[model samples]
Target: MKKQRANDSGWRGSPEVWFQAAIEILLESGVDAVKISTLAKRLNISRTSFYWFFADREELLSALVDAWKDKNTGSIITQSEAYADSLAEATLNVFDCWLDDTLFDSRFEFAIRSWSLQSREIQSEVKQADAIRLESLSRMFSRFGFSDLQADVHARTIYLVQIGYISMQTKESLADRMIRIPDYVKTFTGEYPKQNELERFYYRHGYKNNASS
Candidate 1:
């Protein structure tokens, strides 16, 4: 945590630096708490420095929305685009988002959705993001030989389940989620994952086998 005053120090003053602080505040408190004064104090910088990066607080909020779009929605689309030998494999790629925060942060998602409650603008952005994400999941299913209707339904099922999980603030341990993952993949894709497919996913994520645990 590099905390320093603007006049007496070496703050990079990067937009991302400010954006990060704002996001932290947004998650911890509500969007209203993401004020320039609060962020300046959090970053240990002068309030004037914030204007250098954002014209206004709304600009900063928009930046947060863009960040959520890029990280959460973009990542899922990228995973959906990646090569998968089977439907289950493709489903697991999406599953990686749920398991890994770096890929799709549930906290950010929840925070943004919460913010949406107060602003139609944010709500519209969230809806658009949902459409993009669902489309990506639908395409992933289509590539795996599912018909259009089937792909659409499966995509909605996969996406809504995760959204519902976040909205409900469901709590489950990593080990518990890992134990349920294979069954989840199978149910979504309608085929049991082969051992190798399961192994690849588990090894990539460093999940210990439940049986061995």
Candidate 2:
């Protein structure tokens, strides 16, 4: 597999190769097998070559967290086009994409979450990612008529469910989660989701305009 290029369809030899290999190692053998030496062997490269891409294993892990964050959060914020007709649907598409085979890769998600438990740095990254996610989700809630407190509380539940699901690494299907998010959201807001402005906004852009405020 080659690194994707602006116009090319395959790998161009970059950190992603190692990152995916790391995920594979973690999934096939467990997080314990994702070390630099293991990754080198898995990738048929020298351990010293890892330094060319990352300073060390911790740095590589940091890069992995960044990749995960980009996959989960960054795309929604930067990609979805701002449009009137399908705005909400486009915004919330990130959650929907979580169901995709390439993106949803549950084993990798579970491994990342599991690794985060033992590494303070990883946990910190996860927390930061969650904070951004919650703020984004809260906006969608409020945009759909929920108040600040209500939106925040609802967002918290959603965050917990996602993390808890990863923690449990449930064998359930994405269809189940998609069906269940509405039920989960209804817990605090007392309203079910519809393909309205809010859902459109979330599908198009799942993000808080201002996290600092």
Candidate 3:
């Protein structure tokens, strides 16, 4: 039998490796930088190896968008639906996404929004995500006894404010943001979080000190 080189012996990188490398490039540069050759170079593998994982650059890009939908949009829907004893507590659940990167990837959201400017398909996706997210928030508010109009208005207020934060690239320390959570919950839900509610929220985020209004 002839000797086979490691590269020819199925040394292609895994799908996750290519997908993550693509995301890194997308985040670091922009959508334009996410190319098969670029990713292959970054992974230090044969260009052909990419084909084993993705059909083309477009497929990989689509996967990235899907990931954004799952992580960013999905997180809000999940958090909005989480069980809470009061509207204030429910609002805090949604706020967890803003504070925790694991629940929501703000950098990925920013990159996708930037990519939307170049692709009408992605722009439509972003718009649809906004609608879906807003609807979920509205439902969350309605569950707490808000009228339809009130729910819609409050939903927009919360969603738009968070989007504004991501779009503006606002930076605030965790402690500073923590101190404002109770007021934010009150402002959004028209009900201040109880002391116990605030304590639970702080505990969930591993904050040692309770936030004060």
Question: What local lDDT does model 1 show for residue 130?
Answer: 93
* Candidate-wise lDDT, in order: 0.87, 0.60, 0.90
lDDT by residue (tens digit), candidate 3, 57-140: 888889999999999899999999999989998899999899888999999999999999999999999999999999999999
Would you estimate the TM-scores of all the predictions? 0.92, 0.66, 0.93
Best by the lDDT measure: 3
**Rank ordering of all candidates by lDDT, starting from the highest:** 3, 1, 2
Q: What TM-score does prediction 2 earn?
A: 0.66
Poorest 10 consecutive residues by lDDT, candidate 2: 204-213
Name the runs in model 3 displaced over 4 angstroms.
Answer: 1-10, 210-213
Model 1: residues with Cα > 4 Å off, grouped in runs = 1-12, 210-213
Candidate of highest TM-score: 3
